[model samples]
Target: MEATGRLPAVRGIDAAAPFRWLGWAWRDLWTTPGPLLLYGLLISATSLALSWAIYRTNAAFWVLALTFGFVFVAPMLAMGPYEAGRRLDRGELPRVLDLLLVRKALRQDVAYLGLALLVIYFFWGRIAQIVYGLSTWQIYRTIPEFLTFALTTAEGQRMLLVGSGIGGIIAYGTFVLVAVSAPMLLDPRASVFAAVATSVRAVSRNPGPMLLWALVILALVMLSAATAFVALIVVFPWLGLASWRAYRELVAEAPEPAAARPLNPVATR
Candidate 1:
């Protein structure tokens, strides 16, 4: 459908669109199960090894800090699979390396990606500090005073409760925007503002499905982390493809006009 002057209003589609999109996603996975499995295993093993090393050194805090940094860079790796899926949808063959190369070509978008990460990091750090302070009140307080506070007060509990609520809102907002923006950035033709706005609107319009998707993504993310990152390779690919399919389904596609043909004297005669 062509853009009708105004941007399309968000509306419900056939209930079956999601199912159809999912079926296609599964078919794509089935065709490339080997690499996907191997990838997941490798990610799991690496995450586990790195985590074990960090824990042994009593550098859990450092590990947590590094995760803040990783959040910015890790999405770049998924760009390849994301692009590959987009191409697959368009009936174009895309190589594994194409995912990596595409990012290089879209250097400007990478800057936007970084800015998005910074926004996430700032909120995450604030939430972390609040929770950490509540957990470690004794370190800063005099021993006797700390004991008195803990024994007589509900201050820590209140801090934790408030922190959790704030953190949840930040998490939900971040998830909704980032989930779709990464793939939208891959297009390079679309503006970052448009991509993010569309993503937010998409989630708002279909809260039920989007929430289900968010939960599923969270589960997979936790599973990957629990397995030490090996699960990420498979989970990442699956999720990446699923995400691309979701975008394709939820966002309105702009219609293109028919291409003009070259004029030929023989045809005219």
Candidate 2:
């Protein structure tokens, strides 16, 4: 539904807002640990799968691609915590089933948005491969091999500079699209295009605080990746909930339903 009459006013937040969002997210995580933790476990499994792929192929490029690629597609995955935060805000405990229910609810919007991101991620991987190929003819079989070449060779340095520069642009674009749209999609009244518009507008109106938020996300995601993604068990859900906080602060808060219901209800007999 397009609110062409008066667009939702995006509030201008200060740099400190991102830190505040993190605090709120921390609270949301502990309040509904079961569902949020299940979400984290799923991320852990994905990390393991990626690690297995990298090890099997001995393709260090994949490692680099996935390391940054996660930030590109995290909003959709973080939908679980966003839903949890929404329920918790409504004075209800979010059930594990909401994980599935939230996905179902945003099926149309998320599918389109998620696909757009997946395309960008694939393009990024291809570009990374090209950069690596140009920089080094030899494929690295291990982390040490890759790091030595990357840190010592001029070609390797150039590749790092170019690849990261392009990746940063892509990541910023993805952030602008979904920083608020994912949560907006969760709202029963919001349409995909409308949510996207609001998200872009929100970033445009509050670039300083939004950039701070983006940096916070990058730092946290990098930290999670550093622990072989083990830290993702907590970082993933924490960021998800934190994103919900960001959306809440940026857009005018939607009115909660008068009567709350489980995200997923039992099937009728």
Models 1 onward score TM values of 0.70, 0.91
User: Weakest 10 consecutive residues, lDDT, candidate 2?
Assistant: 260-269
lDDT measured at residue 49 in model 2 versus the true structure, 0 to 100? 80
Candidate 1, residue 256: the lDDT equals: 19
Estimate, for each residue in 97-191, the C-alpha lDDT of model 1 and write its tens digit: 56546753366765686677777767677666667576654442233443354346687456546755765576677777766667767664566
lDDT of candidate 2 at residue 5, scale 0 to 100:
39
Query: Per-residue lDDT of 52-153 in model 2, one digit per residue for the tens?
Result: 788678977688677888888888888788788777666678888887567545567768888888898888888888888888889898777888888898
Tell me how far the alpha carbon of residue 19 in candidate 2 is from the true structure, in angstroms, after superposition. 0.4
Once superposed on the true structure, which residue ranges of model 1 sit more than 4 Å away at CA? 1-23, 34-46, 61-76, 103-105, 137-164, 254-269
C-alpha lDDT (0 to 100) for residue 254 of candidate 2 = 51
Q: What are the C-alpha RMSDs, in order, of all predicted structures?
A: 8.9, 5.2
